[model samples]
Target: MRAPRDKVIITCAVTGNLTTPDQTPYLPITPQQIADSCLGAADAGAAVVHIHVRDPATGRPSMALEYYQEVVERIRAKNPELILNITTGPGGRFVPSADDPKVAAAGTTLMVPEKRVEHVTALKPDICTLDLNTMNSGKEVVINTPGNVRRMAKVIAEAGVKPEIELFDSGDIALMNDLLKDGTLKGPILCSFVMGVRYGFQPAPETVIYARNLLPPDAEFTAIGIGRAAFSSVAQSYLAGGHVRVGLEDGVYISRGKLAASNAEMVTKARRLVEDLGGEIASFAEARRIVGLAPYSATRAA
Candidate 1:
């Protein structure tokens, strides 16, 4: 068994690429709301806030740099201590056309690898996600080819930001190990296991244990559950010597027949759960040290 961590880090994925406003009225769409939600999650004991921006008017996921700048500025103005983890998860989904399998369908967001991390390069956050999955999602496939991932990693490295490797299956873990071996990604890595997605790593204790065992000795991981598994994975991940994550992006409901009123509500529950489990929540500074992030002032000046 991996040694248990003294302090648990709760990461709140305030908004994600796939989650829509229609799924939950409480989902933050505007820059102001996203920033406000992030700040609230921080106040409720989340040391890190995972972010994705959406179009203000239509509530569609956007890769616009302007929106990211606005949200980051707003959050930093309020609480610079909260670690910001921006998403590079957009612009990777592929929906093939019915007539021409090679051609992309209307929902396809696939773009050049460089285009995907444009915001991360320009508005460098403390950490940015680097997805390593090429998996089937319903009828569509999310593609993150190895070569493209390296190209994105190069840009992320140049920006001096930490890459939070998001693993969806056992293969992604294998790929991460390879990346480490080949020096594509540096060690003392930070990663997350995204559970409960259809055809991805299912939410289970064994799955968490299995994935956790595959990671490098120094890797810091969080196991995130989607839909019904969200809260349960908080305890599952913690017990398995990993961190936890929760937000509307992973699930809309906090409990059966009830929606989480805000991301802060979800973080509050996660905090209570961890404390109940005899684990103390990591403060922002402690989490930064654990994740190898520079202090807030140092990051800003970079």
Candidate 2:
């Protein structure tokens, strides 16, 4: 039998919470913008779009089901085969008390585990992320304790949604592994190494190597290297037997000292990297097959 082609799945995270228009003018916020960004990424060779919705009016993070519905509807209207990976990760940010260390003031958005997965259950996305670590994420602390991870895992498993176990460092892989052994995570595993964010995993070949080594063999892994570590880490990830993630969510720049005009540009660059290294890009159907995600027959576009 002839050997199958090595296919690299390109995932584009459309919009994020932390970045603002002041930082980058092209970051998508509204449903139309997010959907457009996904379409652009698809045309640029991306097989998946990982989404986090924002308030259409203020551009702040939103958990409203309608917002997610709009984004999904718009994307599916164009292509039902494109994979949609929603984020259940926004509600976990904890910016501890600025004045007193004892009392947590505002700036935190921690929710009960069930509350966090509400959108996942309602949206029934192809895949969704369940961040598995509690880390000092910049000025804020992003938390996902054992109890919450277990709770959310059950909810995701019951909803028949693939949880993309998001980790920031090597220890996180071990922690997620522990959950599997404990029977908390009960479906096919997908991992994404979020690198270069301050106070998170530093982006480098060695760090990626260690992190990748810690993942379960049954796991399918990808990388998102933010800020200055973007392209270099993606290159390293492909070199290390993994896929790459790109978009306004990960980095605002197309190159050092230059800004990216859109998420499509990011996907285009990622495609170039995979091809230059002799790896083929996965189509939407192929990506679903590789990631073990069942297609959502619930498409409104259908």
Candidate 3:
């Protein structure tokens, strides 16, 4: 794919599935809080808001369709133009039992493919994530087997929502290629190259460039650097001709040893980087055109 020369799309991942409130007090838990944060990020120049709902009381990641619906409704009510990208990648975790090995241990969140994409089918957002590979995302394994990925891809396609093919390492690009060739996925494809996750791909300039080279001709990609590598990855992604993502979901700190005050703060920093590097930030309408999403009104009606 050709590099986006004139505009950069900044995506803010409002709240992720793994991080708890204890880790960062600023994490948005309630649906209202998540919606507010998304509005704040958009105001601060984020073209898209990537959402993952959580249980308000405990701050645990939730797959409840109601939570997803409420969050989307709230965000849309406030800022109808901002692109919404919800996640379907949260319920695939697998932690093996210590004794049996085959049995799922406590904290395992593995679900059937249908259940994983339930929210996407119910609430048709502008975009949804489709993690392309299964790998260890810490102590637990995120099981996205090829069979399940194919199933989920079909479902998401049927729903008319664009899939952001998420990749943790260069090897996962093979699966992306397979999906593209098999007609399970279509162009212009959207991919997220997630870096610095433990046991996944490392966050580095070479790693980012390597993944960029592996993308298909019609694909548009974003690079997200988790934790300390977040800002660095943002800079590198822009330099490597891809878009950028930043928020509490990927990292808590705005800089060395400083926790980001909010998702908007991180986005503000990302916007600065994009502008300083001679690239203009894409507005919501521009992002919609770049990603090939339907109009906001049509999306809501769908």
Highest TM-score against the true fold, candidate: 1
Residues 57-103 of candidate 1 have per-residue lDDT tens digits of 99998999999999999988889889999999998999999999999
lDDT of 3: 0.89
User: Per-residue CA lDDT of candidate 2, range 1-302, in tens?
Assistant: 11223999999987877778788888898999999999999999999999988998998888888899999989888878889899898778787686886666688888788998888898788899988878887677888888878888899889878889999877788888888888888645789999887877888888777887787766778877988788897788888888889888888999888999999999998889889889899988789889886644654335
By descending lDDT, how would the candidates be arranged? 1, 3, 2
Displacement of the residue 213 alpha carbon in candidate 3, Å: 0.6
- The sequence of per-residue lDDT tens digits that candidate 3 reaches over residues 1-302 is 34545888999999998777888999999998999999999999999999999888788888888888999998887788999999998778889999998999999888889889989999888899999768876677888888999999999999989999999977789988988888888977899899988877899988887888888876788889998899988888988888999999999999888889999999999999889889899988899998898766755543
Clashing pairs in 2: none
Q: How do the predictions measure up, each by TM-score?
A: 0.98, 0.94, 0.97
lDDT of 2 at 130: 87
Which is better, 1 or 3, measured by TM-score?
1
> How many Å off is the CA of 55 in candidate 2?
1.2
Give stretches of model 1 more than 4 Å off.
298-302
Report RMSD for candidate 1: 1.2
- RMSD of model 3 against the true structure: 1.5
* Cα lDDT listed for each candidate: 0.93, 0.84, 0.89
Q: In candidate 1, residue 21 scores what lDDT?
A: 75
